[model samples]
Target chain A: MSWLWGAVIFWLAAWAFNVWLANRPVARSRAVQLFIPALFGVTLLILWEGIVRGLDVPGVILPAPSAIWATIRASLPVLAGDFVQTILKGALSGYLIGCGAAVLTAIAIDRSPFLQRGLLPIGNFVAALPIVGIAPILVMWFGFDWQSKAAVVVVMVFFPVLVNTVAGLAASERMQRDLMATWGASYWQTLVKLRLPAAMPFIFNGLKIATTLALIGAIVAEFFGSPTRGMGFRISTAVGQLSLDMVWAEIAVAALAGSAFYGVVALIEKGVTFWHPSQRGRT
Target chain B: MKDTAGIATPVIEAKGMGLTFETNDGPVHALKDVNLTVGKGEFVSFIGPSGCGKTTFLRAIAALEHPTEGTLTVNGMTPDAARQARAYGYVFQAAGLYPWRTIAGNIRLPLEIMGFSRDEQEERVERVLALVDLDGFGRKFPWQLSGGMQQRASIARALAFDADILLMDEPFGALDEIVRDRLNEEVLKLWARTEKTIGFVTHSIPEAVYLSTRIVVMSPRPGRITDVIESPLPKDRPLDIRDSPEFIAIAHRVREGLRAGHGDEV
Candidate 1:
């Protein structure tokens, strides 16, 4: 009961601090921007820890944060193996192959009206198919290894990137095209010089959207069938064994990995599309 | 070769030119029975109200638009062939500089496309930047520059290839009067220095009178030429030349021609 009361007071105090920091007249530095989110996250963790302990919740249902942390420290090698197998081998490779194939297909689609009319609808249909439906079939075909997981990620990522790149190919302004025409530029020259550069922002937008999808598809597909050593496999088996702390630890690893993947892509987008209007400095 | 009156050979010739666009409403006649000739080293202005096909005519010359009837030629060849030969540079109303490119990068684009060597591209970019009085602004991005400066950078882009003929479509129409006047002077100086044949389009009477040796006045709604005023103003014009009697007479004639175009619509 005392722990619950302490958590309530701490939550109120942290909320007040965040509001005060946000309302400050001076602009926040990079450190403050990072610090504020970290503080909020810590406060939530504290509240979560206090409430579960005070309530005396059963570990099988929801383990306390300390138990989760202990499980994470104890199972570091197993987590590392799962991370490499699922993320580096399956998700990252599929991301590269899917994104590359999508870009090329987008170019071909842009070149031909027939392909645009025919393939886009087909692509949309593929995107609409649920990952659950595709995952089982892919596992059946590719066997119960990382290859099946990668195949699922590829299917999940392809359509978003294809649609975005197709749209980006059409992003060049009319006047810019006219300028190229006046120069007597060939079709290839115009595409390389004007259209591709104009498409950078939209392409990056598609790439960023695909990063999360790749991870989700790779992990979820592993649940259909994996080599007994993935985040998804561990999560499922841990739940059956009633090791809720292990499940929480896997969730934490997934959260960190997903965030790092998204952050890296966002950082690359910042570097590549720095001239975009959206990338301009805030007043 | 210049004739006795110092007039060079015809660079652009149009005869009975017509264009009709099929929009959803109906077929809109953009130009009809247009006839004109622009000689080498001449500064000709096409002045008319909005939708008068001045821009349409310019686009035709650039090979961006095709005439459904009649014949038009650039440098004694088809507009398409002339475009393939890279005989002209075109400047649009907006600056149209790519924001991603630096000022020098924008200027180098045409040169690069034409497969000019790196050294020559650098040389021409420097020359055109100096010509536009944008020296030392080579590294700045388009968005970092003022609107007027961006337009000048675009002009420098057109000038970099050193094409014999230049076509401009209301290039300064968006600028404030002060910037317009300043750019007008700089353009005249550029024309004097380069001796390139120029076809300029504008709606402003003073701008037409000040910059053009010949002004082709056009009317809209099946656009047709109503008057072709030959300016007697000398080549060396000061800003105060607008106050002179000859300038005023030309301006008045332009205004009357514009009013006549409106009257025809009514």
Candidate 2:
């Protein structure tokens, strides 16, 4: 059979197996339920691996998972160095700055009507400004270091968090406010006791959304200009050298890190704003 | 408790109280010329049709709202002053329990806000929870309990501060008759024990007559009070009081007053 025929047979068999497994009743244990998705993921990798080799496709078009894993194994120190430089130094710092600025801005916007009218338009403008444009400017301003990557992340993440938090602050209904009023609560007391607590779910939403944006910004901004140690720089250089497996390894690291960051924010959100319906949907 | 008929001074008095709002269409007169008085420790039930300002009148007294034009006094002070002094506790139509907190936590909220010590909050929360006959459901979330239990938790929240007055807006109107009757009896018992002046708003005629020392009948659409009938019931009312002829008579008078208030020109 031709390589395309072989690929088709494997794909069909895998699809049939997945459908059969999905039809069975859910497992009694939480571990088993989690394992099902992992099983499917491994099967997908196997299918991808079989098809790529069977077709005699060039490495540039698609590298097999084993080749990617082998590249990761061969370059652990390089991968670790990039992970530390891009994620810890660049993304984490940017996430803190961007989310911090957004929250302070949101609190200010929530406090004064004047800022809400003046600043939200500016945020909308910032949100519209593409990272492709800002990354180069940030690189120029902050120099070709992790600082520049962090600056790029600040630009990418500031708006979504601000807007969501502003909306959350406005979410307290009339009766709730009236309850505070009847208690003769002072402005600071009302804000600290009621509005801030009420606004938490929205604030965390912005934080969670900003995590991925921070990662993307840190990685993409590095592509504009950076020392040779970062993920974006490595991936670009690897691509130039036709080492496609290295690019895949870097991408895997990014996916894992981004998901972990997002998960942490979501977990904190569950703790802080457990009252919200979005949190209720988790159970 | 004294009958307090034609007392020398009213514990609460509202004179020419009115509230108006300007909508896009025109002015909306929500309340107009609402005059009322309650003697010390009186249980005044405000009975009216929906949209009547029974709840609004209660809110105005609680200072949750400001009447456009009125001179009002509760405990011989302005509504704002009274609210600052923690003169009254209010139970809203909805239980309005915070979803984040457990039942005991919800009960402790008012005490916490009022700057009571932690020990005081715990003590009062326990006392009020038992007062509402919820002895052991403290750790449960609001969603875990039925609607009646949630409302009881809210009532416990309102009562935790030991306010001299209780403002209840349709507090038991949501419950089934069986639960309503049980709660009604419990309220009377609490009133007897504490002598708290309760201003209750409800649409149920029997509920109004069964628990109140007075019934303030209200009208809607530019809401105003139509009548204030004194209840003939003694201070120590019980569950069986609902079957009394005196309760029926007061309910009849409240119904008549409600009808008379409706369709009356401003």
Candidate 3:
């Protein structure tokens, strides 16, 4: 009861403080802006821990945040192995290969209308297929290892990258193309100098989308088949043993990894497309 | 000047030239049986109403649009061949600068494509930047600059290759009157300095009169040339010369020619 009361009172105080800070002129400062979100996140974790402990909830049903954090610290080696198996080996490799192949395919399709008509429909069909159904087949083909998970990730991420890159290649204006032609620019020259640069914003859009899909596909495919390792394998096994805290720990790792992955891509996009209206400062 | 035919083999020549666009609505005669010749170091302005083939003729000369009926040659070669030869530079109505690139990079683009040495490219970029009075602004991106300055950068890009002929399609059409007048003066000075043959397209009568050694007045609805007014004004012109009687008379004639063309349409 005391735990419950403490969490409730702290949450209310934090909420009031956030409201006050948001209204102040000092809120516009960078440190204050960052502090607000950090404070909100801490409050949520404290409330979650308080609710679990105060009610004397069974750990098997829902683990407390503190318990999950403890598990994370204790199972560092296992978690590190899982991160390398799933994130580094499976998701990262698939992301690079899938995105590279997609860009190359997009350029090939752009070169020929025949391929554009033939390949785009096939890509759409492939994209429409269920990941669950394809994952089992891919696991059997690539075998029960990180390779199969990588294949699944490739399948999941390929279409989004292809479609976005194709659209991006066409993003250049007619006036820009005409200028290229007037300069007697060759096809490759026009592509490298004008169309490709023009298409970068679109390409980055695809790449960012592929990052999330890579993680999801890599994790999900492991459920169909995998060795006695990886995030998905650990999560499935941990749940069966009623070790929900370990499951929560794995989830925490996934969330952090996913967010960090997305943040890195977004940072690169800001650097590449600083000229775009969306990226520029209002002033 | 007209009688000096054998002197230098005209810079651009068209004989019974025409272009008919095969749109979904059927064939539209964008140009019909046009004939014109531009000599070396001459500034020629093509002026007419909206539907007139002023822009079409310029595009045809640039090899962007093909003439359907007859022959059009640039620098003693077909327009396409001349384009391949890098015989001319073209400036469009809009600046069309790539947003990703700085002004200096945009100017260097054509030079890169044509395979100029790196040192020469840098030298040419600096010279043209100064040529357009954008001396210190090369490192700035296109979006950071005003519309007038961007247009000037585009002009610098066209001039970078040092092509003998400059084909400009309503280059100052989007600018305010003050900017247009200022750019018009700069263009005259550029032409005088470079001694490049210029083919200018515009709808403004005063702009046509003030800038051209010759004005080709065209009419639409089966677009054709109606008048070719050669200015008797001397090569050396000051901005105040626009207030002269000769300038007003040329402007009034251009207006009358435009009205006569409109009379045919309605």
Q: Per-model C-alpha lDDT, please?
A: 0.92, 0.84, 0.93
Q: Per-residue alpha-carbon lDDT of model 2 for B146-236, expressed as tens digits?
A: 9899988888888888998999999888889998888888888888888888899989888888888778777888787777787778887
Ranking by DockQ: 3, 1, 2
lDDT of 1 by residue, A60-130 (tens): 87788899999999999999999999999899999999999999999999999999999999989999999
Candidate 1 chain A — worst ten consecutive residues by lDDT sum?
A23-32
**Can you write out model 1's per-residue Cα lDDT over B204-263, one digit (the tens) per residue?**
999999999989999999898888888899999999999999999999999998899889
Could you give the CAPRI-style class of model 2? medium
- What TM-score does each prediction get for chain A alone? 0.95, 0.92, 0.98
Looking at model 1, how many pairs of residues clash?
A: 0
Give the candidate order by descending lDDT: 3, 1, 2
lDDT for each residue of candidate 3 in B1-266, tens digit (9 for 90 to 100): 24244335588989999999999999999999898888888899999988888999999999999999999999889999999999999999999999999999999999999999999999999999999999999999999999999999999999999999999999999999999999999999999999999999998888999999889999998899988888888888998999999999999988888888888555
Candidate 3 chain B lDDT trough over 10 residues, lowest sum: B1-10
After superposition, candidate 2 runs with Cα above 4 Å error: A1-26, A281-283, B1-9, B264-266
Q: What's the lDDT for candidate 1?
A: 0.92
For each candidate in turn, the TM-score is 0.97, 0.94, 0.98
Clash pairs for candidate 1: none
**Top DockQ model:** 3
